[model samples]
Target: MGNETNEFDRVTMFGADWCRDCRRSKALLDSLGVDYEYVDVEADLSAADRAEAISGRKNIPVVVLPNGKHFVEPSDAELRGELEAAGVL
Candidate 1:
């Protein structure tokens, strides 16, 4: 599932619907106007593996930021910080 926020321009979210962190991250990203496409780890095995390869963890809510970096279960504060740092917030 996806909800678009125009400010981010680009965002790739790696997660599962069942994950609370994923839910929180998505909510924050949306509230902050961060548009993103979602990749569900459970529903999409390939993405899950790829995310694991990069993060070395099976955790949900692994966000691929617009600048081409990854964040593993980052907190709301962290996401806000990143958005501010990227000048999107």
Candidate 2:
């Protein structure tokens, strides 16, 4: 985990450990030294509902940004751009 600048500095990722994309996204975040809160949808069923509330779909690797924006199963490039835009990269 990285520094916590404020309440909104947290990056919330909703996905299960078995998900490949989730692992990839987490790796990217870790590589870039970004702190994130990983919500395992499988471990806690209620987390799936939270993911649906944010994404409007049942998609693994739903990444919720600090500003409440999200990317659903984004590519590496897409995730990179988001990290750059957030000043994390």
Candidate 3:
């Protein structure tokens, strides 16, 4: 997932292309028809640090909501809650 999203109330995903968890997050978002913006830390230093700062781990699939609330390695249920909260679902 790159900085290519389609919905408003941007959901920013900070991850690398090689990350499976990131891929899972991307697939989930796509299945929900909720467009989310993606930032590749592999290419952007800011994104890497941002994800690290929020998650406290170098874990992939760190998702930042429009309001700047973040989720680290969240489950599908958790992600659904975020989508609902953001009125995306």
Candidate 4:
């Protein structure tokens, strides 16, 4: 499906296709029907560095929420909680 705008504005996820956690998080977000920008670190040469800059760690699936809060490799429950808090769930 196309990534369209939604209540969760400016939500960006930096991840790679090969990463299991990234896939899980992506699926969770999609299943929740929230709009998010997905940047594949493997496709973009600098995306890894950008994700690291946001979370201060070299990890895939750096999820940046609309509130400017970010999570690195967050669990499903943690992600859901944040999304609920942001009124997106």
Candidate 5:
């Protein structure tokens, strides 16, 4: 992800490609037609640190909603609820 001021303004998901939960969430976002930023923690140490800082957990798939709320290792149903609540779904 870039260092743009608006980077986190939208729905941002910090995760690695190899993570099953990450892939599942990514697919959910895609299926819902929700726009989001995917930060590959495997590719950027700083992004990983940021994700940990946001969720206070060393877990993959830290999904930050546009409202500044975050979910760590959330299930598909949880993601769906959040997206719907955020009016993105």
Candidate 6:
């Protein structure tokens, strides 16, 4: 788990199991020991809508940060940059 004092204490990742980028992002978070809530868009249709609303696009792997910022289908480097910017790195 990540630091509780940081803004990334608990993030929300909106994605589907079948998505490659989602899996990669999840792996990155896990490797970084980041605490996050995984929301399966396939299991819950509303999650897809929520992801779209947050990112303003129909893309999976939407990572919702604790500070209300979000990343949609971000690469590992992008994720790292965001985490670092948020003081989670």
TM-score for each of the candidates? 0.80, 0.85, 0.78, 0.87, 0.89, 0.85
TM-score between candidate 1 and the true structure: 0.80
Tell me how far the alpha carbon of residue 36 in candidate 2 is from the true structure, in angstroms, after superposition: 0.7
**Model 2's lDDT to the true fold?**
0.80
Q: Write the per-residue lDDT of candidate 6 for residues 1-89, one digit (tens) a residue.
A: 12223334468899888999999999999999988899999999898887787778897888877766788888899898888787666
Model 4 over residues 1-89: C-alpha lDDT tens digits? 11222333677899999999999999999999988899999999898998887777898788988777788899999999988987767
lDDT of each: 0.75, 0.80, 0.77, 0.84, 0.85, 0.82
**Index of the highest-TM-score prediction:** 5
Cα misplacement distance, residue 24 of candidate 4 (Å): 0.3
Off by over 4 Å in 5: 1-7
Clashes in candidate 5: how many?
0
Instruction: TM-score for candidate 4, please give it.
Output: 0.87
Q: What is the C-alpha RMSD of each candidate to the true structure, in Å?
A: 6.4, 5.3, 5.9, 6.2, 4.7, 5.3
Which residue window of length 10 is worst by lDDT in model 3? 1-10
| Alpha-carbon deviation at 8 in model 3, angstroms | 10
Task: Estimate, for each residue in 1-89, the C-alpha lDDT of model 1 and write its tens digit.
Answer: 11223333467788888889999999998887877788787887798997776667888787766665667889899878876776656
In the range 7-59, model 2's lDDT, one tens digit per residue, is: 34578888888899999988888887888888899889899997887777898
Residue 73 in candidate 6 has what lDDT?
Answer: 86
Which pairs of residues collide in model 4? none
For residue 6, what is the lDDT in candidate 5? 34
Relative to the unseen true structure, what is the C-alpha lDDT of residue 38 in candidate 3, on a scale of 0 to 100? 85
Q: Name every residue pair that clashes in candidate 5.
A: none
Backbone clash pairs for candidate 2 read: none
**Candidate 5, 1-89: lDDT as tens digits:** 21223336789999998999999999999998988989999899899999988888898899988777788888999889978987777
